[model samples]
Each structure stands twice: as C-alpha cells, then as structure tokens.
Target: MSTTTAPAAGTSTTGGPFSWTDDGAAVTVTLDGVQVLTYTYAANDPQEESPRPYFHPVRTRTGDLVSAYRPHDHVWHKGIAWSLPHLGPDNFWGGPSYRRGQDYRWLPNNGAMRHRELGQATDDDGTFRFAHSLQWVTQQGSLVVEEERSFQVVPGTDSSYTLVFDTAMTNVSGEPIHIGSPTTEGRENAGYGGLFWRGPRSFAGGSIIGPGGATGEELRGQRAPWLSFVGQHDETCRFSTLVMVDDPGSEHPEPEWFARSEPFACMGPAPFFSQEVLFEAGTTLHYRYGVVIADGQSDAQRSEALALAARELLAATQGRNGQ
Candidate 1:
C-alpha cells in the first residue's frame, strides 16, 4: 500500500522545509544537512537514497562496514548499501563492498534504512530554496522517474553545497530508453553503480577516466571515446571510469582501456549501450550528473574540479552542449 503525488511542475520547497518516509514501499526525501533521495516506484527495486532522508545527518554507525581499502570510512563506493530501491547485492568476496557485490541488486539491510536526526550539518538559507515535483507511476503505465535534487548553502561557501539535478525518465517500457552512463555502461554490471579498490601495491595507483579526469560533452562513442586510470591514496586520489558499448563501428564497443594484471591494476571496459538500449513506451529522459568531491588530485586541482562541475551543468542546460 503506497501512493504519493504532488510536488512537480515547477517546484517550490524553498529548501524551506523537508521530511518524509513510507515504510510500505518507497519515497524518502530529506534535503537539509545535504542529500538523501530514495524513491522506488516498485516494479522491482533498489536504487536507493538514505542517511540524508530518515532524518538529518544521521549516521552514528549504520552497521559500520569498512576495510578492504581505507578512505576515511567507505564513502559508499557502490550504491545505497541497503535501501533496496535500486537493488544492490553482490558480495562475491565481502571486502571492497563485496568486491563488486554482484553488481548489487539485493536490498534491505533491516533497520529499515536506519535514520534519526536532530541537528549538526546544516547550512540554513533554508539549506536550499526548495522546488518540488514528485511523481511515481507504475502498474502497466510501465515506469516514470521524475526526481528533483536541489541544494544550497552558499552564503559564503565553506562546507560548500550547491547542487541541482532535476531529472525525468519516463519510458513506460516499450523500447528505446537507451540511457547509458552508469559510469558508462554499468561498469561491471551488477547494480549500476560502482567504485572499488583494495589498497597497497602502492595503494593501487589512480586516475580513472580521461579529460583531465572527468568530462563528457556531446558524447556518442569511439571517435576517441574514453577510459581512465589515476591512482594514489596517501595524498587522496583515485580514478577508474571506463566507456564501452559493444564494438564494431562501436556505438558501444569494449576495450579503450583494460589493465587487471591479476589484481595488479588498470581496468576500463566502458560499456555503453548495455545491450543495445532503446525505448518507446513514451520515451523520456533528462540527464544530470556531477559527483564533485575534491581537495587534492593535482593537475591544477583536477582542472579546478572539472571547471566547477562544468559551470553548474552549464546553468542546467540553458546553455546546451551537455555530456
């Protein structure tokens, strides 16, 4: 028993107020301390959103699972550990988040997404001027994915937090969704979200993708696609984001990079069109991605954090030329 329909078509939360939870199925949105967007419209789940939801910067120690590779306590190297909204299960080894946790699909870590907040981790300014639009339709309607992720805390900018990702993915499922880029073709296919490293061997050298680190504009494939690798942990830095589709005239071919010298390093498969992606039920997709968490990674501070996340996703598309 689950149903919710309201905030969409222009948004206006003003980052003013926030809070939600639906134990029955899905829907968890908490944008105060920073982020937490869990919305599963059923039809198979796991692609979660936690911590930021349940309530405030709550994470006293959600089952603490760290060790396989250190980095200030596993910063969710994979997808949501156990929200079950997007399915993440692949513990093939248990270390490095299950060494790829079977590409993750298994959900629920009990504790019902454990959460609880009161204070500490706020920016105020309302935190981010709210703009809300929510929709989750299923049942033969196929699928509709509309999500609004807003952020704010730029009074002077210190702890820093100014994000904005308004997404809309309606396929209804007839064919033709063709939405790639789960690190470019689900990186190893399991959950559709990844990042793994085991430590030592010189902390597994770094650099994941290319273009000073990460950047994609009007991307299709080949014609000099990409596959990256950059390593270093002592100083804080890591990279590995491949790009592949299928091969042959390669709309999505494989190997633009590969180096797995038996746990030695270097691996970029860059799979694009998972298996020839296509959609037609109603065909809908709006892209947005900017995972910027910087402080080190040279080359002039990783090209100044990819030019400040490409100038805020180029003012959110007003200035096209996106990637």
Candidate 2:
C-alpha cells in the first residue's frame, strides 16, 4: 500500500467552528476547543477483528460519550465504523463467520480494510472534510476491492452537528462478489452491517425513533429513510440523540434498518439486509449517509427535523462533489 506523511502530532489549526489535532494515529476534532469526536485511521485492532478505521468517543457538543469501543460482548464492535458482515466468503465485519448450517464460527475468512493513503482535506468555513484511499484485502492477502471514503463534519446548532460519510468501492476481484448480512445466510434478524454504530452500555433500553412516528425494535427490517436513538448517560443521567439518514440518491434509497435497544443500543441502514447484492467484476457500488449527534433527547418531531437537516447537508455536499 502507498504511504503518505501524516501531520505531526499535536499539529492543530482552527477553522470556523472546528479545530482538529492529528496525533499520528487519529484526528480529534473539537468544537469551540472541546473535543467532540476522534477518527482513528490507523487502528491497531487484531487481524481476527478485521482491523479497520473507526470513530470512537463520539460525544455530543455537551460532552456526553455516546459511542463505545471493544465492548465485551462483541470485541469487533467498534464505536462507529463502515463495516460489512459478509463479503462473499470474507467476513469484513469481524467476529465469527455465520455459516449456512454451522451457525457462527471462527473462520479464516476475515478481511481488513487497510488505509493506503490520505486524500484531499479541507478545514474551513465551519466544516472539516477529509478523504482516504483504502484496500479491502482478505486474510489470504488477496485484493478484493479498492475504496475511496470521505467524511464531512458540518456545523449545526449548539446542541448538534452533522457528519456525512461517503464510500465508493470498486470490485477488483476477477469474479463476482456478493455482499450480505447474517440474515441472508439463514440467521434470522441479524442483518447488522454498513455504517454500524455501537452505543455506550448505558444506552441499553434507549428509545428508538424512526420516520412516520415509528418506535421500538419493530422497526427492524423495516424500510426507513432515517432513524434515531435517544439514550441517557451514566452519571449525568441526561439524554442524547443519534440520528442516521440514508441518502435517498443511494442505490438502495430507503434501506431496511437494523436496530436494537434491548440487549444493546445500535443501529444502521442495512442496504443488504434481507438479500445479497452481487457486484460483478470491475463494478462499483456507492453509498452515502448522514448522521446527527445532538445533546438532548429527540422526540419523533425533533428526530424528523434533525433527519431533514442531515439530508439537506448531504444534498449540498453531493452537489458540490458533482455526484
């Protein structure tokens, strides 16, 4: 993989509402001098976990940690990651491979999305945007896909901020590859993948909000444009909200959502929830999502408003990129 020089540790500069510090392995973004989130491109996770880039310690503007990392139940469950469970015979989501008849088992099919090089970056106009080039390689050292991923942190109200994530992957393997989740492999309701988020332990039993005034785990496998989770913090007992919106212009406009609040609080727009998407050789797939992290609990109306704001931000970004 090609390498590039990373900014020196402690190197920081202020833009409009954001300032970022690069500590060699990660970039920590702060709003008004208070840390909000840290994106780690050089994660040192074990190969079995399919080491990949992730965002951890994601906090609301008020400093309440909403993201989790390396939790006991699922060590592979990072804070917020662009993870995929089944990529043909490879397991890019880490953990055990869910077989058709064998159930979950550790296989030699784990893959990693290794960072290749840094791309364009802009920290101005109350926003911070960056891109990265990555390689999706299987455990056997075979290249499967080349990806260009970009992230944008945009200014929002005092209680919230918007994070836009975009990924374009080109199949480089000679044969067709199928991307799917556990449900597609016969395991029921386990379709958890694609820009997944793992909430803090305290978030268990949190409230869920979706489009159309929907709520609860029943929203799982249901098509939705956006979803939000409201959870209370540990000590402060204050509430926070996380809203995720799937770009309507994506290949899968309104994807089925994989959400949970019982055992744990987690959610994501599962593009390949019930079926597998086949990518022929040399083909490309692109997806974009927007997330809003806010300090207070968001009711159905508030959640929808936040989702709309995120959608608007995403649309503006897409227009700028000529997508």
Candidate 3:
C-alpha cells in the first residue's frame, strides 16, 4: 500500500497538482514566489522593521505568491529577497531622522546591514516539491549574517499543505562562526538574540522574544511548544500547519522554541563565533529547518504534516545547482 494523496480542493497553491506524502507532513507550491532571504541574522536593536524582513510560504493554494505579508507595511514578501542584522537611524520610516535634533533626538541605531542573494529550488519526487533561497545582511562594513533558506511542502487530502524550512548560515569572509555553544551568544549586555514566537495574550506569555522561561530585557513574545501558528474561527483552528526549524550545528543545537511559532521568528550570532569556519576562497555555513503545515492542529494532522514537509523539501531541491 503506497502512502500518498492529492489535495481535495483549494490546495493548488502553485497551480500544478502538488502531490503529497505521509498524510500532510509537508506541502509544495510554486506560484509567483519571491523566495525570501537575508544577509544579517540579528536585529540586535530596534530597526525600521522586523529582523526577518523577508517571508516565503510554500503552498498558499494559489499559483501566485502572496504578493506581500498580509500584516505589516505590505512589504512584499512572497518572492522577494531581504535582510536585517545591524543598522543606524532608520531612514525608510520618515527617512530616518528627527525633524528637530532637540525634540526627537536622533539616537544612533548602531551598525547594521541588509542584503540578499538569489537562492536555488528543486523538485523531482512525484510526491512532494521544494524551493530554496538565501539572504545577506550586515552593518556598513561591520559584520555580516547570511541565511540559506529552503521551503518544502506536503499536500494532504483536505486541501492541506505542510511547509518546512532548512536554514543554514556561512561566513562569506575568512572568519570564525560565533556560537553560544551549549547556549545563546552575544555581548552579555546585548542579551544574545533569542528564538521567540508571538501568540495570543491569554496563551500565558505576552508578545516577547527570548529563550523559553529566561526573559531578556528587550522582551517581545513567544509561543508554546508542539504547535504551529494557526488562525481560529469559532471552535475550529483554521489553516492547519506544523513548522519546525532547528540547526543541529547551531549554538545549542535543537533550538528551544514554542510549537505555535509558525512562519518562524528568531535570530542568531555569526560574526562573534569562535568556531569561525575560515573561508580561504569562499567561506560558507549552513543550517536545516523543518515545517509541517496541515489540517487543524491535531495529533494526526501534525505528524502527517512533518512527513510531508520533509519530503517536499528534499524533492524540490533538484532545481538547485541549475539542475
């Protein structure tokens, strides 16, 4: 008995009948995707926008990308490159300056850079598919944080799609890769960038970003574990999906993040790494993440989604390397 399925309805995110594997552990879609990415990793300080200025979703049921993130400045996500690691006074919002030097006070936002490079995508398995890209961000000649992102998708019976992310970072320059090895990293006072998730208020913790339990000064919010960010209408959880991203080689390895953190929101340090991987010619690093988008947050749904996300991520990777 072969384990596979075809989306029931409304599951054609990229147009072509995105196949499935193991229920709904993942998903695959190829619409007008922009493929989000960045150069800098951490938004150490409050910048013009989010540390992750880019967004890429695998299966939105439409052959076209989502245009832009539904929320926020309509900053055009789906298929656009992006970055955020350091910076100075934000110029995008109000052109980065106080009308009056005395009233507003133009405080220095420090050094930060935003850059991105094109990524690769592929898919061959008749069951699933995937897409991969990269991001580059750094300060003005300060430090750089780059990300290699891969988006995978698994289709299910009820128009469900599981999304997975494989994340990796490399030191383009001949230097070491920082790590809070066995823990987070930073200037201590800088409160090392934490993996956080934003959820409802009643969910216990407010909107804060930091390690679980251990709160940081620049608190944002976090989500509960074993769950993914899914909307709710009445008693039903809409848009079922499970997304998991962990870098085994990362500082702490299996990063401690909440289950409800879908679409993903977090950061890490790369420049200060004592484990810097010197690049004689082209120094690069890598990380792998996983996501499972499914139907309603259910025990059966999540499991199925994970399998799908993993399969799609692996399947769609054929398009990389100009394959």
Candidate 4:
C-alpha cells in the first residue's frame, strides 16, 4: 500500500458540503463538520473471520450512525462489505460454512480479503474518488481471486449523500471460481451475501421500503431495483434512511434482496442467491451499486423517486464507459 503522512488531528479541508481526514488506517468523510462515513482497510481483525475492507459508522447527514460494525450477535458482519458465503472451496463470508445437507459447520477454509494496493485519492468537481486492489486468500495463504474496487462519494442535498461502489474481479487461482450464498448450499431463504449492511440495535422494528412497496421480512427473497430502510435511531426519534440501488449493468440487474428487523436490522442485495456464478480462469466480472444515506424517513413515493434517479445515474455512467 502507498504510504503518506497522516493529517494532523482536527485538520481537515472543506469542498462544498464535504470534509475528509485520512489517518493512514482509514479515511473518514464528513459533511459540514459532521462525520458521515469511514472506510477502513488497514489493521482489521482477522479473528473476526473475514478480514476485508469495509465501511463502518456510515452516518446520515444529520449525524446518526445507520451502519453497525462487529455487532456481538454477528461479529463477522462488518457494516457495509462485499462478501460471498461460498467461493469455490473457501468461505469468505466468515463464520461457519453451510454444507449441502449437513447444514452450517465450522471449517478452516475461511479466507481473508486483504487490501494490497491503494490508489491516490482525488477530488474532482466536489466528488471524492479512490481505488483499491485486494486479494482473496485462504487460511493457507493461497490466492483465490483479485479485485479492483473504486469508490466515489458525491455530496447530495443537506439531508443526504450518495456513494458509488464499483468492483471488478478476476479469478487468479488458474481455475474456475464458484460464487454462491448459503441458500445455494441447502439453507432456505437465507440467501444473504454480497454487499451487506448491518444496522444498529436502535434500528429494530424499522420499516423497509422497496420498489414494489414491500416492507419488513416480506422484502426478502424478492427481486428489486432498489430498497430503502428507514428507522428511528434512538428514543429521541431521530430518523435515518439507508437506500441501496442495484446497477442495471451488473451481472444480475434485478438481484434478490435479504432484509431483517428482529435481532437487529440487516439487509443485503444478493446477486448470487440460490445459484452460483462461475468465473472462468483469467476472466473478470464487474458489479456496481449505489448507496444513499439520508436523515429522514423515506416513504414509498420517495423511495421510488430515489430508485429512478439511481437507475438514471447508472445508465449514464455505463453509457460513458462504453463510449
């Protein structure tokens, strides 16, 4: 990874409504002096199972933390992370691996996705952009896959902001890599993998709104272009909204989403749910997603509007890429 001098404490610069500070281990983004997000790549705990890059304490514009990291119940879940439960013969989603008929079992095949390279951070037209190169290695330190991920943070309205996550991965083990979720291995309706998000305990009983007006557990196992979870952060009723939109250009444009409310809020857009996607040797696969963090409740109408906007943005980006 590249090395740079850590910025002094409390020393941050502003560009429009965004401010950021890099302390070598992580990059924190703030809005109007209020922290909104932190991208941690260095010094991650391997004991947590999947030592990978993740975004934690993702806060709304109003300063409410909507993202949770290393929750006691599911220590493997580290806020917003892109993970897969079953990757060929290795487990990268952490915890126990689900067997075909024997059910979940503890295995030593757990792997770690380590950050290997970091690109120079740049600010372009008020947007912050960065790139990362990571390697997925098993416990025995054998390479399974390599990924190039890019992140773009755009300042939105006073109450919201947008993050664009794009990843391109290649099979580096000289063999086919099979990507799947728990559901594909025998579990029913437990197709949770890929870009996952864990919410705070205060978000229990929160409402989940999707493009089809579905809510709560009913939203699980359903295909949707976008989904939003709105909840009160505390007794004071501080509302926060988290919206995730699947890119139409991705492998699975209409991916099934997994959502939960009890035992703490959590959700994910599982593209490889109930099935497996094979990545041939030396071949690459790309995926893109958009996340919106807002400081208010998102009703069905608002959620639909946001979804439409996200689709348009993705379409435009893809068009430019093709040109």
Candidate 5:
C-alpha cells in the first residue's frame, strides 16, 4: 500500500550528489545514486503495533544492510523508531504492555503517531534533510501529543555516514503525561524504549562498544553519551559498525543505554530507563541524536573517533538552528 502526492517545494527527482524521493507515504535519501535510508511516515502496520514513523533499510556507506523490520521475536520492532512504551496510561511502543503485577498483556491503549503535514524538505549540495509534523493519538482517537520530527543525513568519510534525528513533542492531552519504560513498571533492566534500533539477524552475537573501552552487555543501564555495535554480515562476512550518540543538550543528557548482543544486537539511548518524566499539560520535551554507520568493525579507538565526529556535526547543526 502507498500514497501519492505532488512533489513539495525543493523536492528533487533528478539525481545529483545527494537526492530525495518523496512517495507521499515514505521518503528515501540517496547518495551518489545509492539509497542511504527510507523513512516511512504512513505505515501499513497493524493497529496493535501502535503504528508510527520509522527508518528502515538503513545502509552503510558501502550499501550493507544494517537494519531489521518486524523480526519474529518482536513483530513491532521496526528498523529504527522513536518509540515510547509508556505514556501515562497508554502504550505507544506497541505489542503487549508490561503491567507491574499482570506481566505482559494486550491493552486498548495503543497510540499511533500519524503524520499530519510535511515541513521543510531539501536535497542539495551533499545534504539531505526533511521534517514532518505528526499527531500522537490514542486507540480511541484522542490527541495526546503534538510532535515535530526532522532528519538530516550527512556524508562522512568514504566508509561512513551520519544521520541526525531531532524531535520535539508537546503535551496536548489536557493533563500531565508520564513517559516511562517497562523498567519503570517493574521489569528490571528492561528499559527498552526511546530511539530504538533492531539489527539484522546476522548481527546476532555482535560486539557492543561503549565509553572507557567498555565492551559487552554489562554496559546496559549505564550512562553514556555514545554507544556502538559491531557486526559481521552473513554472506560476505564483512563487518560494519553502528554508533549512536545522545545530544548533551537533550532533555536527558547522557542517557542510560539499553544494549544487548546476545539474543540479538540492539542498542539505544533510553531517557526514561529507570524513571518517569512528567510532561506538564502545556510543556514540551525535546531530544536529538546522531548516528554513524560505517563499513567496518569499530574498535575502541575508531568508535570513539567516529562518535566524536558525529557529535561535532550535531553541534554544528544545533548552532545553525540557534538551539
């Protein structure tokens, strides 16, 4: 299923150094004629999944697939998405909700983030950027939050690329909204929420890298400004590294990470890992992150260098926006 629309201003159809293809339902970014990533705003997922915008088919500079969608263990685990498992009494992360006493159960509180409008979109001079306005509504069709999301993909070295994601959400539910994760609901160290990523099955048993030369699942729930996962592809046995960096200016700076490489390779900065953040009725919350996707396994030194480069890029972007 797809939706079609007239191209918005600044939308490019001709190929150049970098280009964009907006097919209404989703948008794709390409570099030198190769796709880097695709963001799906109008998903055709089941309501039970609390459908929301996500980035899939994310690729390294060499075009190696690094993302997974609807994996068996978690059908709702899309490639890369800004998902929140707990929002007051609603569930926006999809699948079963983890109640403190009742364990996991399906509830009628699934909320969906529906794309409402497109904002500025540009593809020029080695840069590809886009923005979207969305409405977060509950299963019963009631507004909970108004959100604005933007993305910028930047070229790094020949073997790596960087993507910056920024989001601002305003509470419009008419009351305070509590945002949290399963860990806040009694599931220990299960703080799997916020900007999440699901890696391909071939990435299983990958290496997790963090600050201070940290390597392993022990970094889970640990505070860090950046984290990385190094995985080897199945067919060619080539390695790739993914690095995620949390903006120091975000609502939750240096967030605790929810990382794992045993059962599957996945990692993300969890803002509400162990606590709930209260969003007042008229308040807004913001978050920004930079991701570096490279074509080889990143050792401690390389991962740190790539993370620092991404941080500099994000800082420059924030400065340009006067944020």
Candidate 6:
C-alpha cells in the first residue's frame, strides 16, 4: 500500500521543509517539519465508498489546516479530490448515483480508483515531483479508465506554496465514456466536478474571486482562467487564500468554475459541467491545474497576479501535450 524511498544524492534527507513520505495508505508532504498535506489512496470504507485518492488536511505554511474531510453533511466530500459526479453509469464522485429521470439515489454502481503505483522524481530548486498510477474500476471490478496523475510542489515565501495537478486519463473500456456532472442530469447550477477542494468551517465567509473581478455566486457556472477563494478560520481567526489556475492548454480551456461562499467553502473548475464530454476508445484526455495556498486574506490584485503566473507556468511546462 505504501513505499519508501531514499533521498537522492545532493538532496536533503533530514526532514527538511519540503519532502515526501509514504505510509502504505497515503503519501504525506511536510513543511518545516510540519505536515502540510496527505494524498490518500487507500479505501477505508464499506461498499468501497470514499476510495478515491484525495488530499486531506491541506495546511498553510504556519500549520493552519485549510482543508476538511468527510464532513457530516456530505460524508462523500473528501478534502481535496479529483472526481466526476457522472461518469457513464459509475459514480466515482461518491454518494448517490444520479439518474436522468430517477434523480439521485444510492446505487451499487459506485466505482473506486485503485492506486497502482507511486514513484518520485527529482526536481530542481525548491520543488518536489511525484506521480501516481490509478485504475478506475466498477464494483464488479470492471475497468473503465486508467489515469496517470502527477503533482509538483513549489514552496514559496513563508507558508505560501504552489501545487500543480497534472492528470492524463485514457478510456480502457473499449467503448466511449461519457463524462458529466449532476447539473447535466438536471441539478441546475450544481455542475461541480473535476479537482474539488473543501475548506474548513472557518472559511464559510470566504470571498471567491476570479479573473476580471467576478465574486461570490456571480463567479459560479462561469468561465474563468483562474479563481481564488479567501477566508478566515472561525476558531483561529487566521486568514488563508486558495487560488486555482486553469491550464489554457487543457482540452477545456475556459472551464466554468464552481464557486460557493454559503453552506461551505468549496470551488473548482468543472469541465464537463452542464454538458457532456465523450472520451472515445483509445483516446487520452489531459488536464492541468495550479493551486496556490497562502496565509492571508483575499486580495483581488495579488490573487489575479498569482493566477496569471500559475497559468503561464502551466502553459510553458505542459505545452501542446496538455491540449
């Protein structure tokens, strides 16, 4: 379930500020000797529920937890995860499967993405690179898709850092796969899917800012190259900002970002959204996103700059391959 690796030559092996460690079930990243994030792949529930890989307890450099996991209201909502509410007949997004006329209902068609391999690669400067191979399988153990997901962590000043999520998936079911969200199945503006982040309770009053100065519900279901959600922890009164930059090279360049300020803090760029995307057999789809987490309140100008920088970086690194 887990693998350990010795730091390569010229790399610090004394529990430095940025490092990766695997403990069979999850790979954790630590900053300045404090845990910042954990990528968990192990399935720890019945019916194979909550089996998808996710980042939990994402923290600021100062050690403030910014992400939440398995909240009572939405047990299937993990901390930070990549999922689709509607993937053909399989529910990889957890909870109930949405049907066209039947609405949302618990179904045995819930699938799980099993982590197959974990590997680390060397990176320059203060960045770390790693990857994961996962299989999307149905409850009956039927294969639907295979994904190669990678992450690059770039540490910034103080508790600020950038986490890049690069994912490449191929349809291995010998048939076309239809990807969509709950909105496509009649849920209205609830078109949430893809890379999702759930913030802590303290982030309830956070402001969702997007490119061009869009905020709050106005930013939802709208296309944006990047978006930022800033809020403070109710208990700690400490502010934090989370910025997501969409890769212009992605198949869905202008993805409609799903942002929320009430109920709970959550947002992400939903590609399929209200529409459906078909992944033909033998075809691969690639997506790239940049996430910047910092300890501070939401600043429109600064967040816009951060998003632009992230977008440029993703464009340069991914090039045309991400398209």
The most accurate candidate by lDDT is 2
Candidate 4, 114-135: lDDT as tens digits: 7777664655566666676788
**Cα lDDT of model 5 by residue, 1-323, tens digit:** 12234253233444546766777888888876678898998787899999999999899877899999999999999999999999988988899999998899999988899888777667655567777788899999999999878888888984888888889899988999888899999999998889999999999999999987999999999999999999999998999999999876565657999999979989999999999998999788989999899998789999999999998888778833212
What is candidate 2's lDDT per residue for 190-256, written digit by digit as tens?
A: 8888999999999999999998898999999999889999999999999999999988667565799
Q: Please count the clashing residue pairs in each candidate, in the order shown.
A: 61, 0, 78, 0, 0, 5
Candidate 2 has what TM-score?
Answer: 0.96
Q: Write the per-residue lDDT of candidate 1 for residues 31-76, one digit (tens) a residue.
A: 3433343333221222222221111111101111111222233323
Question: TM-score, each model?
Answer: 0.22, 0.96, 0.45, 0.92, 0.94, 0.91
RMSD of each: 19.8, 1.8, 11.5, 2.7, 2.7, 3.1
Off by over 4 Å in 6: 1-17, 48-50, 121-123, 319-323
Please name the candidate that would achieve the greatest TM-score relative to the true structure.
Answer: 2
Worst 10 residues of 3 by lDDT: 34-43
- Point out where model 2 deviates above 4 Å: 9-15, 319-323
Task: Please give the CA lDDT of all the candidate structures.
Answer: 0.29, 0.87, 0.32, 0.79, 0.86, 0.79
Q: Which window of 10 residues has the lowest lDDT sum in candidate 1? A: 58-67
- Which segments of model 4 are wrong by more than 4 Å? 1-15, 319-323
> Which is superior by lDDT, 3 or 6?
6
- Candidate 5 segments whose C-alpha is farther than 4 A from its true place: 1-16, 319-323
Error of 1 at 318 (Å): 24
Better of 2 and 6 by lDDT: 2
Better model by lDDT: candidate 3 vs candidate 4: 4
Candidates by lDDT, descending order: 2, 5, 6, 4, 3, 1
* Total backbone clashes of candidate 3, pairs 3 or more residues apart or in separate chains: 78
Error of 4 at 9 (Å): 9.0
lDDT of 6 at 250: 69
